[model samples]
Target: MITDPEIDGDWDTAQGAESPERLTPRERARGGPGVRPWLWALGGLVVASAVWAGGLYAFGDRLSEPTLSYRPSKNLCEDFKARTLSGLTGDLHKQRPMNQESDHPAVYGAVCRLNNVEGMPDFVVAAQVDLHKKTDPSTEFDVPPLADIATIGDVRAEAVSDLGERAVVLTSFGGTEQKLKVLDGGAVFTVQVSVSTYNEKNGRPATDATAVQAAMIEDMRALMAALRK
Candidate 1:
């Protein structure tokens, strides 16, 4: 077979792992027979490896990539339905499922707040959903209040208004907040989970806010778990 010399220029790998034979090209060329099988095998392996690597690079997007360990739970919104909208305008809290691939939609009257470990101020999340209206589903373009609680454009920040009966009523979430991101409209509504830690001093969370962040995440998880129903 005709093999390219460039692919496996050095046949060192072809030698057994614990091989003690030190054969050089000069010596082998002078010797009777040459290491053809090993050389060809190594060359084939190299070519195969190159092709595999090239395919991966070209199709990286289609490949499965590593992601966060936590996935969307089917029982994420159960509690919100049972206990959230109970007192507010009769049991009106809307319930929905959360997906791992994209952001969840807003449910009217579904409200939640989380406290950071740092004993900072609490963060509030208000769901401004249109359970009554023919609203679009998906997290892509979130409307104010329903899917978004916090609004900020450069040097401005505040909450939205005119939310329906199932709206969230909380202070601020934390520096870390969830956004509206809908892949395909599934009649799915968006819910804006507010995020903010106590600013006792400044409105934003402090630098050493890991504790607060952990608490917030914990609360969010708990709330989501309760919404499964």
Candidate 2:
């Protein structure tokens, strides 16, 4: 007969079967599915990393700057034209408004004179805008609305000349860093002449101009031909 069997220890089975071995901590976590579950976990981690990277790229895509628009005004002028050489005689009359004292609603004004007797506005190319009037003539140089009235600059007639019995003159104004010019083709007897350009903003010019100085000059020549009596 065999001795009494030891009951406190593990046992083995017949047919080459043995008791199960104790699993290590890592082995316990990876039991059953072995490396398959670890491979699946790694795949999930890679997919999460890829999604995170994609989101980061999308958020930072718009790193460029935006552009602004600025359209300030500047003046311009033209020199000689067709009716220069003719000789006008006698004193020209000042043209006052028939009914109204001023062109309050008008944006532009260009009237020629045969004489300087009338206390008229001498601005051949004046665009009377609806901004607060800037009365200052020093240092600061900009139109109204953009600048206070006291700091605004000027664009006015700077000189006049009577060449060979002709009332040719040079007009200039300095402000807003722009140089505007007005050319006068003096007086031919009872008819005097002047030309000016409107203020421009941005790249395009004002659709509404106050003085078509050059056009007025041409018209004055035609008028002289008709009124040469």
Candidate 3:
């Protein structure tokens, strides 16, 4: 009775029996039936790229904005009032003081070098101001002063209060040189005074170390005020 389904008129039943499904010519031209998975993978990659780009844009904007409250001085030598140092040394060098200033997107800096008469006390005073626009300097601010003790013999460093967010004073070379550093917000201020031992041998009484440090602190406050204005 089953003489041969193919030869019989029931050929349609034989053709539909146990045959695997096949894609149309149109489907094959469009990358077969698995193309939807490929499209989904591509769409996921695009979304991830967009999210990464947005994050970078937001972070860059935050870094570009300045966080400092104080401003940079056009001429540090002219703006700084060295009354305390002048009172002790009599007068600064007649020649123009050496000064440097810079303004940039990430930072602002000013520095001034004031020296006493050649033979008087022969002292040198250096003042500097730094305004950080992007990052906080507190973590690294105290490292240098503290490191001096290990690097140099007879160096002393102590923390100071009431000057700013944080302050430090470093004295070296038997109190002949003193540096005062203060950090406020994102601004860093430093005042350093140093005198040579030759000045003591030349019959000029050695300047009082205590008085020198006090004068430095006083002048630093004045300098900060001037820059703020």
Candidate 4:
């Protein structure tokens, strides 16, 4: 019988070869060549996690903390003179102004309400100041006017330029009510003026939306200037 030397050699090698060695419990637990890829993957994940944690610890505050340009007012009524409104409405009367202030680690807030006076056309002006101590107010600065739109239908919003980092005017109640909001750095300023539609004593139209918006913007600028650090 003629036999191929290559085939005979393969059969002889296969018959002479012993069974593969079995791994002990300790050796199996320690891992084998098959487990090397998984060990490398685990080591890579550990290194990545350490890097991320170290980065957060080193620069988290610098990246997250906001830089505030303005300071909080102790009394918003004193800071907000409402001079433009006084001119438009009339002389300031003896009505007591409402003022509130709060100071905390995260934020500082102040609110003022100047009620309607006898000599002036029936109008109320409210001013609010928010100085964010920890975070940037810009993200949520435009939210109030938007909320006003959702709450009070028929409201119109217009963006005002050259006032601050950003400014918006919200008009409602047939131009009788106007709200001006300005955001600069971490500070937020809001001025809202509500006047009667008609003057009963003078028998004249009271609300001039354009004039009110102008006055509101001017006064808001003044208020922002007054509260700056």
Location of the lowest summed lDDT over 10 successive residues in candidate 1: 179-188
TM-score versus the correct structure, for each prediction? 0.25, 0.20, 0.64, 0.68
Any runs in candidate 1 off by more than 4 Å, and if so which? 1-107, 112-136, 139-152, 155-207
lDDT string for model 4 (151-217, tens) is 5666777999998899898888577778888888788888988776634334323546788788888
lDDT string, candidate 1, 149-220, tens digits: 335422213322332212222223344554321112122233444344334332332432344333333433
Q: Rank order by TM-score, top first?
A: 4, 3, 1, 2
Worst 10 residues of 4 by lDDT: 11-20
RMSD in Å for all candidates: 15.9, 23.4, 10.1, 9.4
Candidates' C-alpha lDDT: 0.35, 0.29, 0.76, 0.76
Give the candidates in order of lDDT, highest first.
Answer: 3, 4, 1, 2
Model 1: how far residue 119 lies from native, Å: 16
**Which residue pairs clash in candidate 2?**
88-188, 88-189, 89-189, 92-114, 108-210, 167-186, 167-187, 168-186, 195-213, 196-213
Q: Model 3 residue 122 lDDT?
A: 64
Residue 37 Cα positional deviation in candidate 3, in Å, after optimal superposition: 28
Candidates 1 and 2, the one with greater lDDT: 1
Error of 2 at 114 (Å): 14
